[model samples]
Target chain A: MSAVGSLVAGSLAFMAPLAPAAIGGLATEYVGALNIALEGLILVGAFSYAAAGSIAGPIVGFAAALLSSAIVAAGADLFSRKAKADPFVVGLGVNMLAPAAASILSQAVFDTKGVAVVAGLQSAMALPGLRYSDVASFAVAAAIIAAIAATPFGTRSRAAGMSRDSLAMAGVDYGRVRGAAYFVSGLACGATGAALAASVGAWVPNMSAGRGWIALVAVYLGGKRLGGTVAAVAMFSLLLSAAAAAQAVVELPAELLLSIPYFTAALVVIVGARGSARRSARRRAP
Target chain B: MRPGFRTRFHIETIHDAGGTKAAVRLVAALASAATLAALAAAFLSSEPSSALRAFFLAPFGTEAAFLSTLELAAPLAVCALGVIVSFRAGHYSLGGEGQAYAGSFAAALAAPVLYEALGPASVPLSILIGASAGALVAAPSAIGKRLAGADVLLTSILVSQGVIFAVDWAIGGPFRDRSSNLVAMEALPRGALLPRLAPPSTLTAASIVALAACLAAAFYFDRTRSGAAHDLYGRNQRFAELQGFDVARLSWAPIIAAGVLHGAAGAMMALGARGTAIRGMSGGIGWSAIGAALVAGSRPQALPFAAVLFAWLDSGSRQASILSDLPPDAGQAIKAVVILAVSARPAIAALRRRR
Candidate 1:
């Protein structure tokens, strides 16, 4: 394949994991919670799905990943609702806790800390050089979009975040909705792990590879529009692919290349924020 | 959106703070036990008793373990004090990780350069450089929050991650020491290093410095007028602004100061124990500091105990990993659960108060 073709393929590969996460994060974003544990959830999926997939089968692996992540999300939601702690901090707690637990489990079970190869995985279903994960990304994304636009619970989740106390004080079962949002996030993250692991045929520690954070960035940058969120994720994944390409050619430091996504997110925030502020200021002025 | 007790857990119900302290402690202890029990059942079912013993008692089993724990606690306590300061000022900066990494790198790079020109004073000068590096990294968030109303939490993290990546590359690539087999930078000479205060362990005067930082922070928060105003502003922004406090300055100053404190803690790590900057050496010190701060209720006075408790968790985990089959990161899991358990204390109190 040509370099450009390969880059395009890589972009799709990057987008496959991140798209589900960004879509899932929209659920949490709506419910006034940033599920910073998105990364941790993705790792849980990457590890468990692969481990189970190799041992049992893909379907069972997928279920195991989803179940495990849901349990974690449930705990995070409980802490957010009952503990009254900063949900962001709680998210960070879960992020730390997940990997630590996964690593310990891996050590006990697999006897390795670096990578666990999923045995009995047939292959990445590919045609014309595009993997199954790429197609699956779009399928899952469409479902998420349809759910958000058509569901009553989605509207409630959106209302929950509009103010600090409205959802907390509302007559609706907002806790359940918020909890469901977190669970949805977990489910999406599970799909993300399964897709990525299927392509690579191994569960690499830290396999989420900052995609969780990048997904959060995309969700925010998309500004509540599903289409906009997809576009944002595509743009980010393309930039990440381009950066990887550039690192191969350029003399720049590898770490700097790795940081391009985060730096781009920061720039997006600052520029987007300033642009909005300027427009709002003009609208208010004579 | 309301800055609700950024660091301290305010669960007062017209009751004495004293009464709740015991309640919080009891709840915290109970939560830790529950968490450990759960972990044991799920992960350590093979040899739970032995693992628990190493995790709990091994840190104090030997003088070496005890002093090493103290050494680890020094940086954590110093960084936790930084957390308290920023949280008290209503600036929730999660940039400690990047700040500490930047500080360590700066100290390592600057100490060798300044040793010849400044001689013995290079120690302090190198520390100042580390602090400045941290401040430089943190300044954008403070400025963005003050001027543009951009959320500091988001900006600080983004900026921090960028800096961490940059520093990681530099330490691993161009700036790495060519002579050393280890992935570390040039070691600071003897005069630039922190002098050891205790024997048989790497206990240095930096530990005293860490304690002094906590004491001074406690004094400032409890006794000073400026500290009171900062606290009031952090708790209620509109009320503080109406009361004629400089809320804008309050927003920025605390963040910068916290960066400086985190930098100093990083400097202590590089200069005190490692004597050189190593890639990824900052590890989880930043998160651990935040954990300590949260468990301490963001009170400077209580930070030392919180730091030591967490330090024990870390050292004990290592001991367990070495003496038994338990892996190193199991300690991290236990510590995280313990932190969550500790934070639950105030929440339970707050829930009861609400009822």
Candidate 2:
């Protein structure tokens, strides 16, 4: 394959895990909440996949990851809703709780807080040019698109954010709609974690790194549109791929190289925000 | 339509309505945090009694431990003051971690030269340089928010995270002390270090600065006309505009001011007993400051106490880990619970209404 072709393939593999989490961020965004805990949720999913996959199989591991993440997401949402506290604060709490919880569980079960390796399964579903996770990620993105475009839940979710009074007048339970969005976000982040762990055949502490935050950035940088968000994710994944490739030739420190995606994301958001503001100013003038 | 950008949580300073209610809530939250810590120790440790005692009592067990805890609180108190400044201006600057790290790096890098040139005066001057570095880190977010209507929270986190990695690189790479075994910069000049207040304890002059800052902030926010304008601008921009306040300056100035405080806090950490800019030293401090600020209800006068409370939790956790088999992180989890509990005022009010 040409260098360009290989780069594209590399980006696909990288995007496989990240796209779901970014999409999950979009799900929460639609509900008028910024789920900052997405990063922690991804961590939880990675740990679950590694722990379960090593004991059972990849299939079981995937199921467990999804279930556990969804439950955690739902539980957090329920706490915020019931407590009437700021969802953002509760999300921060979850972010703090996740690593601590994971470390404790890891030490209790695996006797190590560093890494948990999956047994007998290393990219078990590799395709000709793509991994199983890559294909599954594509499928998940498509399903999410279809659900939002075709389902009543999507309309209600958007309504809960954009027109809460109208939704209430229509006799819909706004809280439930928002809760469902959190559940979806959890499932998506879970998939992201599963893909990340499966690719390495192990879960390292903080394996999610900053993918969760990057996904949050993609949500806004994509202009809050699903397709735009996916495109943003693709762009970031490409950056990651490029950064990885650059490491071989670039004399820069590895830490600085790793920060490329975050820097680019911030730059994109700033530029995009400026453009939007200019357009708005122009619209107001005439 | 794009949602309008806003701060994640509302700011309720000491002058706000329901001061008594806020105090009650804070006390309840602290008590709840203590209970949670005890429960966690009981569940996580083989020797539950020892763990509980260490977590609840060890911070005040010895004079050294008490002073060390206060020393830790000094920087945290300053950081919380930063949070209050930003939040009260309706800007959520989540970049405290990065700003603090940048400040420490700048102070550490400049300390030797400053000490040579200015002697003992380099201590305060180095802190000022640290503050400037922090402001520089926050400038992008401030500019973005003021010019483009960008969300401060998002921009701040992104910029901060990126800066954090960059600072990490500097500490571990080019600026790293080659002779030292640890990934850290060369130690700050001895003369530039904060003067220790107690022998064998990390307590220093930073505590006095933190207390003075809190008191000064409290006075400014409660008594000055400009402070009233600042608060008005934060709570309601339209009304402040009608009242002839400078909205533009208010929008950006508080954020920059926050950067300054965060920077000072970082510099203090470097100058305390550590006397060096170490890799990852700024970890958790930023978020904990936010928690402390929230616990104080954005009240500057309450910040010192809140900071001490968090410091105690941290100190006790360390003690528990040493004395018993309790996981050190359990204290952090308890702190999270405290944050959640403190912010649950609305729910508590609702329950009261129902009753």
Candidate 3:
């Protein structure tokens, strides 16, 4: 493959893990909350899918991932809606809890500390040299975008997120709508984790590795628009790909080089923050 | 108290997910979580009887096991103290993992050089340096939150991950001890290690420091004027500013203090027990500490016991794994459940108002 071709391939591969969560998070974002448990949800999904897939099959793995993630995602709503817990706190707690759960589960089931291997997970399909998982994530993103654009569920979710009082006045149960959105959001992130494990063909502890957070960053950089979010993910992936490609020639330490994407995230936040500030200042001046 | 102040205090107190309801919730949640864990073990373990014995009584089974549990709790308690400071100040810094890691690395790196010059006096100085490193790592996020309105949650975690990646690389690549088989650097000199409680038990003087830190943190938040001011600012920043408090200072101080305590904890793990910066040595302590802080409801008085409880759970699980056919992660599951339960407080009063 050409250098550019390889970069594109790398970008797609890296972007797959993030795309589902970003797109799904947009649903929650529309419903006036961000699914903070993206990391934990992803982790749970990856482990469930990997463990189940290895034992049964990939289909079973995927189903297990979806169900587990949805349950965790719904916990946010249950706590926030009925019990009135803060989403962020609940999310933080889940993030901490999920990995420990995964670690313990792996140790118990597989007797592994940080990794468990699954055979036959390697992609048997490829399109134009793109990894199958990458392509599948793209398809999932497209389907989600389509659902949001065409479905009543999408409209209600968006409405619930944007303005609760107005949504309530319109005779819709905004909380219920939001609770449903989080479930969907959970599935999307869960799938992302599963896809990530499938890409590696193993359930490695800490494998999600902040990809969920990156998905959130993509959502921010994309202006919360679907296309922009995908594009932002592509951009970040390009940086990662370029960093990977550079390692053969670059004299810098691998750790320093590995920090490229995070530095980009910090950079994106700074740039995004400043732009919003400028826009707000202009609005105030008027 | 007047109705107005009482209401405002209610608002602030509930934000940290601890209070009257929390105490009740803590017991209820803990009971259910523990029960669930026991049930899982009864079903899951190959040797249920041995697992039960290890899980419940092994930590107190012997002197070494008991002291080892305290040794583990010491760093965790300090880390929780770090977490409570920031959470109480209304700033969430999830960078405790990185802060602790950085502290360990910094102390490990600085100890030998300092030891050569200062003799035994270098131990405390190295630990101080280690703590400063953690505080430094946290500074950007703290400053960003104060000055730029950046999301401290994201920024702190981002900075922390970046540091961990860098440090992990450094320990593996640049600092790789050609002499050792394990992926770790040189061990601290005998003088550099924290004085042990006794032989065959790894408990050290660092446990006392951790205790002192919890007491001080509790006293600071509960007794001092600055602590009160900090709480007011955390509960309501605009209200604090309106009432003539220095909101900006309050905003950053908790984060810095948290960084220090977290760093100290990391330093403790290195200087007190490990004797060197082992690969991923500070792993999970940050997350465990956050859960521990929640269990304590950000109260210093309750922190030690909470830390010990977490240590007990962890050590017990390790014992179960060692003595019986039990999974090592079982303890982690229980800890997660407990943390979730502890942090599940909702602003019920606010909900009632809306309704």
Q: Write the per-residue lDDT of candidate 3 for residues B67-178, one digit (tens) a residue.
A: 8889989999999988888877777777899999999999999998999999889989988998999999889877766665555666677788888888898788778786
Q: Score each candidate by Cα lDDT.
A: 0.76, 0.83, 0.78
Question: Please, what are the lDDT tens digits per residue for candidate 1 over residues B32-92?
Answer: 7446744653476466667667777778877876877888899889888877788777777
Candidate 1 clashes between residue pairs 3 or more apart in a chain or in different chains: none
Stretches of model 2 off by over 4 angstroms after superposition: A121-130, B3-18, B346-355
All candidates in order of TM-score, best leading? 2, 3, 1
- Candidate 3, which segments miss by more than 4 Å at Cα? A107-114, B1-33, B344-355
Model 2 over residues A1-286: C-alpha lDDT tens digits?
A: 8778878887888888889998888888887777888998998888888888878887788777877887899889988888777787788778877887888788776787788775664566576457786576567666776776679988888888788889999999988988998998898888888888888888788888878888888887887888888899999989988887778789887789878777777777777778877777899995
Of candidates 3 and 1, the better by lDDT:
3
By TM-score, is 1 or 3 better? 3
lDDT of 1 at A56: 87
Error of 2 at B233 (Å): 1.8
| Per-residue alpha-carbon lDDT of candidate 3 for residues A179-230, written as tens digits (9 for 90 to 100) | 8888888888877987888887888888888888777767767776667777
Question: Model 2, residue A65: what's the lDDT?
Answer: 82
Give the per-residue lDDT digits (tens) of candidate 1, residues A22-107: 98888887776777788888888877887788778876876777677767787788876786666766777787787888887787
TM-score of 1: 0.89
Q: Say which docking band candidate 3 falls in.
A: acceptable
Model 1 CA lDDT for position A119: 73
Docking class of 2: medium
